[model samples]
Target: METGIRDIVLKWTAVVVAATWIIGCGGSATKPSPPPPAFPKAPAKKPSVTSPKKATQRPYKVGRNWYQPIPHAHGFTQKGIASWYGKKFHGRKTSNGEIYNMYAVTAAHKTLPMDTWVRVKNLDNNRSIDVRINDRGPFVRGRIIDLSYSAAKRIDMVGAGTARVEIFALGAAASGEPSSKRPPAFVPVDYNKGNFTFQVGAFKERKNAERLRQALDRRYKNAHISEYDSPDGLFFRVRVGRITDLAQAEAYEQILIEDGFNQAFIVAE
Candidate 1:
């Protein structure tokens, strides 16, 4: 009976040891604890940057002359002979790419920046006009400013062609408060009262005159070809718009110049 009891105890001990070994091997094969529950990676960061500002002023040249426009022209002042340009340059482009308008209060300067507003006083007559500088010119020596035909008329320089004048720069229009006053109205002249017209082009060849007339007709009203017998020879004149007064004629001339007819001028009927 004692031998049988001892054998039963040994069997139970062997069973317990085998069960412990099985549990240890199963836990070791548990997929390495699921790789510690993998997490997503973060994105990389980028650096910031900035750019430099552009320059506002630049130097330029025309013909034999070099010019450096003033970047800032406020408070600038000058005194010299101011000449007037009419029908000859009436319908042309200004230095600033604007259509030249002789009727508008505008002028041209050599060194003053474009779009500058200036007060011009005719020293001879004490007449003053406010003009915007929209072109570069008076390339002629001894001349300081080139006034538009209308500007010249304001200062009574139309008969003289030029006048001694004083000019004061008032800065850019954008930099100052806008004027509330309306611009001067263009007074129309009665066709029956006077004989005036804008001669846009003159050609010795009738065919050339006809071509210009056709071009002008497409862009302007009342464009026509008129024949003129000059001492040199017969010439064809391409005229546009009849006017009754010199002021009205000059205004039409300005329109032609802006249209690329640089030789356009006023003529009496």
Candidate 2:
């Protein structure tokens, strides 16, 4: 009798356990899984900003020829054939790596340092305009400068195709010392006094100057290489015969020219 009662108790206990499990599972299903484990949303993206590339004022090559830019534009003046380039070079990368804009008041020079501002005066009409040097070109013989379309138009040279213009470098574009009301009077370069030397060659490579210096030291007295730290890079200027007066330097320069160093020039030391 006891065993039968125990069997009935066991069945009742099983039914109760099954009902509790089913009810517990049903409650869990209705509870919604803790919102699927929420994650923090990413921050909104910001617009990207791009900066202009810095210009390099180093020596560059065109065709088989190489040209070195001048270190400074102080007391710089030149009279040359000025030509303008428009659609052909518009939106192109210039020598200094700047985008070319035909309408901008900019110009190109074969040897002038980049960012130099110069006043271009047309010799024919006496019209003048100021332009900043940002490129390098007009590589043709006898052409001194290349102007932008608008710069050439302002100087009354667009119709002429080429104009004889005198360019006087005012200063660097960043220099705000010059008066905008009146053009600054140009002071001619002094070539009389001060110690001077004959610069026979300038090379971007130090070894090239070293080889020349070694050859010069054997033949020419006081031949040495002077280093110049330009904005673009270091330059090795091969010079000879340091003199106190400009006249002696000029005399030595002629001698260097006669010795097959035709591009030799006198530079004040």
Candidate 3:
């Protein structure tokens, strides 16, 4: 006990060292697991493909004495004995490439376009009539307007066979004739010039023109064709619309170009 310190330290050191080693080796280390991957949401839808809401169209209802536009008729000037036509000539062809009817309350005026509307006031009885101008007549000179057979009876001019009257233009009027001419017909500066159509090309075949028409109908709703079968033969021609806005019309020209219509241009409707 007095002289051996090394022997006593070595005996206790082994037990402490062995215990530390056993305690440290008893525990095991664990590795961490990875997280799940995140998924992305789809993109938003665009607006171009959506369909537009349709508009409601209004119906026109009229009774008696309505003069609708008949392109066959135009021009007027007259002073004559107005005689009416009826019964036998009803539904017959008039001079202006249109059918005539006695019941329609129509009249005739020389040099005036067919399908014109005239207000005939009887000079004798002062009676009045609204007649559709379809036929042509009054071969005699010094007579300006001629009445359809029915028009003359309505105004009591048939019995006399002669009446003084006036012709009026309604809706869109032709040149020299108007409701009233306060604003000059010719405006040097065209502030309100409207868009119109033109025929850039023509074809003898209707099928070709129709195919072009279908491709343009959506962009140019007014786009159409006119058929003229001259003494020669049937001819089909493609025509763009009478669109009021020229700039808007230009936009359609681009569409036409994309659709393979090259030479397309604007024309008067």
**Number of the predicted model whose lDDT against the real structure is largest:** 2
Against the hidden true structure, what lDDT does model 1 obtain? 0.60
Model 1 spans with C-alpha error above 4 angstroms: 1-56, 175-269
lDDT of 3 at 148: 54
- Candidate 2 lDDT by residue in tens digits, 1-269: 01121111121111111101011112357556654322223225411212224445455556544455654576668897888887666667776666776766888898777667789999999999988777887877668888988788898787667999899988653434332122354334443567655556667899998987887676656778988776557878887666676555555545544544435555555
- Rate residue 35 of model 1 by lDDT: 44
Q: What lDDT tens digits, residue by residue, belong to model 1 across residues 1-269?
A: 11121111121111111101011112446456544322122214311111211222333445533344544464468899898775556557677666565666778887776666788999987999988777777877568899987789888997776899999876565423332122243123232235665554556899998876786666566678887665556877666766665555555545544554434444555
Residue pairs of candidate 1 with colliding backbone atoms: 87-264, 90-257, 91-256, 91-257, 91-258, 92-257, 92-258
* Higher-TM-score candidate of 2 and 3: 2
- Stretches of candidate 3 off by over 4 Å are 1-78, 171-269
The TM-score that candidate 1 achieves is 0.45
Sorting all predicted structures by TM-score, with the top scorer first, yields: 2, 1, 3
* TM-score for each candidate, following the candidate numbering: 0.45, 0.58, 0.35
* Strongest candidate by TM-score: 2
Tens digits of per-residue lDDT, candidate 3, 1-269, equal: 11221221122111111101011113234855454322112225311211211211111112211111212222323344565555445546665545554444666654444444566777666778776555565444345566655567677765565777655543223345431221233222232245455444445688887876676665554557777554346666576546565555545545554555434444434
